[model samples]
Target: MTHKQKPVIGITSGDLNGIGLELIVKTFADARLLDICTPVIFANNKAVNFYRKTISESNFSFFHTREFEKINPKQVTIFNCWEEEVNITPGTLNETGGRYAVTSLEMAINALKEKKIDGLVTAPIHKTNVQSEQFSYTGHTPYLKASFNAKDVVMMMCAENMRVALVTEHVPISEVAKQITAEAILSKLAIIHSSLQQDFGISKPRIAVLGLNPHAGDEGLVGNEEQTIIAPAVKQARNRNILAFGPYSADAFFARGQYEKFDAVLAMYHDQGLIPFKSLAQGEGVNYTAGLEIVRTSPDHGVAFDIAGKGRADGGSFLQAVYTCADIIGQRAEYGEQRANPLRKVSPEVVSRLEDEKIEE
Candidate 1:
């Protein structure tokens, strides 16, 4: 956790047919990135070489390892999880690509739980194809929540300026309204508040909660969720000493630059938050699974299957994910230290008593 001793960051090569490996290789190609953290990729050497050659990125290479202890700090390492021959068909969706993506993710998660890696930065995975008996979740947030046995977790998408957390994820738009309740809104608010403090190191995070309906239900003209569900939840959160406010109309909140006034924003659903975040982030956003004991992050974008093998996929988001993971690890370490030995604030009466005692002495 020191400046000289870098944290080991584990990267999961997403679907083989996707741009996972390409981003991994391109991100690590910069030698200066090694100064912050040691990267250990969960992928086979064959797959790595395949992508390297396909992208004409010969300068990129990784140290092959079968054991965690064998990872090299000065160079990037690729831990081989599978050796079976599989066709590396880019821009195609198949079960084989999904299976290997799961394999790489499983291995990386094991390493993370074993303390071999400090944090995890995952690549994009084809959610539908990656579905299997072992993995039955909708996305990474839920999977990680179950993996760590965390009771509640928030899917927070972050950039330099804007940070947005979702109340409902991976659910259909029709089911979204049904899922929006006072309890659900309150739970997400609590998680978002706690995560902003612990994970991002915010002392008193100001969170803006977006309404479920348009114009925040037009004051209950369009929908009653704002009054019966979201507004009540905001009131309850405020009563509980959480710095939460507003069942703000989503459109005006962003349009008026009101998001910048708060530490974080909680959206009611997926597109409500992601659309604005992606548009404003300019391809530098990171999807962070907050409220978990361990740190996990991924690029905000999904697997670019259309442009998978053309060597045209942008690595900016993936690189930002890596840097964001490292930064959160450091921030959490510092937060822990501060929590262990917090500075005491002396009241005026206590200070007067101390002064009197000093005078008597």
Candidate 2:
């Protein structure tokens, strides 16, 4: 039997005009990354060269190949998804950018599905530009959920100190409340718990649930969603043996640094979780999609159109994303191996007989 010591990670060149390629080039400039995983960039040679030239200071280069078998483990490989030269106008928003971004993502996803790649690290895409008749989703999370036919998925933000999972992502504030049901919270909690244990190697995960209303509804005075909706969901989760607590006031929880006490925090909405996470992440946060059959991670930030081609884009989050993807791949393998064969429990009678036999011997 043989196993690959290094995982193959597929990187998508996000928008042609965005900082995605810059981040990719900057992150891989160290060359040490190839030691952990074989890097495959799903983009044309033109795009790769464009970014490489734009960031002239970077000495990073890639092995261009259209064939998967020719992928080099010791160097970066550019898997040409398209040969047509694209007009890459950095820091610009247009339909062309969106369309090309989708193309790159689709190619990477196909490779992931075929097991050609062990994990995926997607670059950020503009939610508006990427939308078309074929791709109508808001962002990567829902798109991935539908792509893999995943029953559910949570957009979990991971940083050095804390992990935060959103209950409702990319939804308007008014619609957020309507979507916050007991079932929704429980579903997210279950996914978060499983992800913590499986993807993160937490044996027993503790999840802190954030409240929807101010002061957690102030004990039903401010709002009752906390009492009627959230509290019940926590109880149901506990009944199912999940260590889920709170419906805690969001402001207080993060302000008091209570998130440090738990394995992960589940917020009622996007801003509730992300605002604090981005502030705390300090430019090194990775957005991981949990409950997927495959590993997918991206930089916590979006396509910084302002800093796209200026070579000022920070690669910290993207670098962390790569690390996180490889780590989860390894963790899942270890977790699977741990559960592959369980020790059979000995009966009390067998134990007593064994003890007696041992004494006689």
Candidate 3:
């Protein structure tokens, strides 16, 4: 089949007032994207209708189906959740809009679980707006883990030349220092290694790890996470044939294209990795959840409530997210047909079983 005829990409319309809808329209306007993959927006038909009236772009065609077997790559589909005529004024965050943002995610996640879509490309979701007792787990990575029952998962953010994995996320700076365990480090390293090889097609991946404090704590002058935790993790990973090194200081690590020297970097917390990533990427990064059974991706930036609907939301970030999702789906489809989600088949208990067999041999 041709590129456009590949598979339908499920995109969740994040917040009605945010730039998600605008970017969706803008991104698909480029006819070249239609040559790659068709977007299956998991949102209401009325929302698209309103956006078309406001923006005057009416290229959206819908494909409605309750089952996975009806998904066709030829049509840009819309699975409407609620038909209440939504008044989507750009840049305004309301509770009603937030409710829509969440329902879109729930439906898309369900679609991914049922293998209805090739991959999930979520728009930016407002944390305050995403309501539900079950949705109370940090960000998308943790939410995906909770949905998939994955105990250990890592967040890897990537641009063209650089990718960085997170060791800790969505925690206070004070609490991050206390959360690093040897087991946690090793598990993240293993996941990073496997992901690099499997998804990125890297044979032997190299990872550079960052320190928790400034100056890497100046050799234990200010803090000791380097000596106490990070260093041990690095050594363990290296012993396992994973090239992991450095408790590098975060701010100074990005000089003269240093990120190109390694396949991925493991940051101690959120800002340490993303601050540099966003700076280097300049609103072109793809936020990827690495430890999921099914591939999950989103635009690196949050809902740009500031620049919502002035016809100014750039489609570059959203385009990148779709491209990354399609690339992953294509790669994995070569290995296992219809088994796009690994979480359904691969469990930690399964890993333990394989390891036991090797030991017995």
Candidate 4:
């Protein structure tokens, strides 16, 4: 692709003590990847070099640039967010690693706000270590939502075939029952529907919503959430012309492979959706934050401190995250173009004029 055609993807080096930089370096080692998009890594020189040398990937080189105008499309570039030297100890979690991780992420987000990057591909970050005075959020989805001031967002885990979205994320399992309300379900459905149409290029998306209770309440035998809250939400969504259905029993729905018939699935809580997504995605899935103005994706897995410096981390999911971000950018652009100026109906007089002109020719 040409420079103009290639999207500028900003990559954040997640927890320095984790496998964030390793995956970033490994994915960009392939020279052919530069042909698709320009990747700007948000990391200091010390952190980049530590991972490069530890991984023994000497062939991977990047240009240092503070300004986006100096970005080299034909090569990988590191945007220096910090210049100070920091200790790099793999498999260890500390406050410094979390602080630097937030620094890198904040810089990339600012660049995205300024239109310096087309999309963002964030690596894994330790949810606990990354919390501080400036950064205090459950995870990336909530943080990104608050950063962009978005009213609602969907934590959609997507793979090649299956796509699962969550209505409640990073919330306590005990509170899951109390949180399952008609208003919340309806809001998530709206976000999912709009995201499917604009971000995934689905004109009429068919959404499958999962039930909160076992057996979908077994018709009030086990619970009443399915009938009282979920059913009403589905009705409201349908009234808005959204192609939504279900209060389906989660287990039977996936066991019977019913998810294959829908464009997307909306689970009532995090584990209800993520357990199946991770199991089925098989390390090839991406966690995409839908309903944001800008596209953001991350590897479905978290910071694997166990394999941090062992050079044993797989780059498949991270690579897929980058590709997914690029794909969403392209999809949104195409969707916008189609929505901008739809095909106009031709009049009979214009049709006759065209016929007469063709006959004369």
Candidate 4 lDDT, 1-361, residue by residue in tens: 2223889999999999999999998999898889788999999877888888877644788899788899989989999999878998899989888889999999999999999999999988999998888889998888999999999888999998889999899999999999888998888899999998988888899999999999999999999999999999999999999999999999999889899999999999989999988888899999999989999999999889999988889999999999999888888877776667453245778877887999999
Task: List the global CA lDDT of all models.
Answer: 0.90, 0.92, 0.80, 0.90
In the range 25-60, model 1's lDDT, one tens digit per residue, is 888989889999999999899998888887764478
Candidate 1 Cα errors over 4 Å, as ranges: 1-4, 344-361
lDDT of 4: 0.90
Q: Candidate 2 versus the native: TM-score? A: 0.94
TM-score of each: 0.94, 0.94, 0.87, 0.94
Superposed by TM-score, candidate 4 places the C-alpha of residue 3 at a distance from the truth, in angstroms, of 12
* Backbone clash numbers for all candidates listed: 0, 0, 2, 0
Q: Write the per-residue lDDT of candidate 2 for residues 148-236, one digit (tens) a residue.
A: 99999999999999999999999899899999999999999999999999899898999999999999999899889998999999999
Error of 3 at 90 (Å): 2.5
- The runs of at least 3 residues in candidate 4 whose Cα sits more than 4 Å from the true structure, single-residue gaps closed, are 1-4, 344-361
Model 3 misplaced regions, further than 4 Å:
1-5, 56-70, 335-361
Report the Cα lDDT for candidate 1.
Answer: 0.90
Is 2 or 3 the stronger prediction by lDDT? 2
What's the C-alpha lDDT at position 284 in model 2? 96
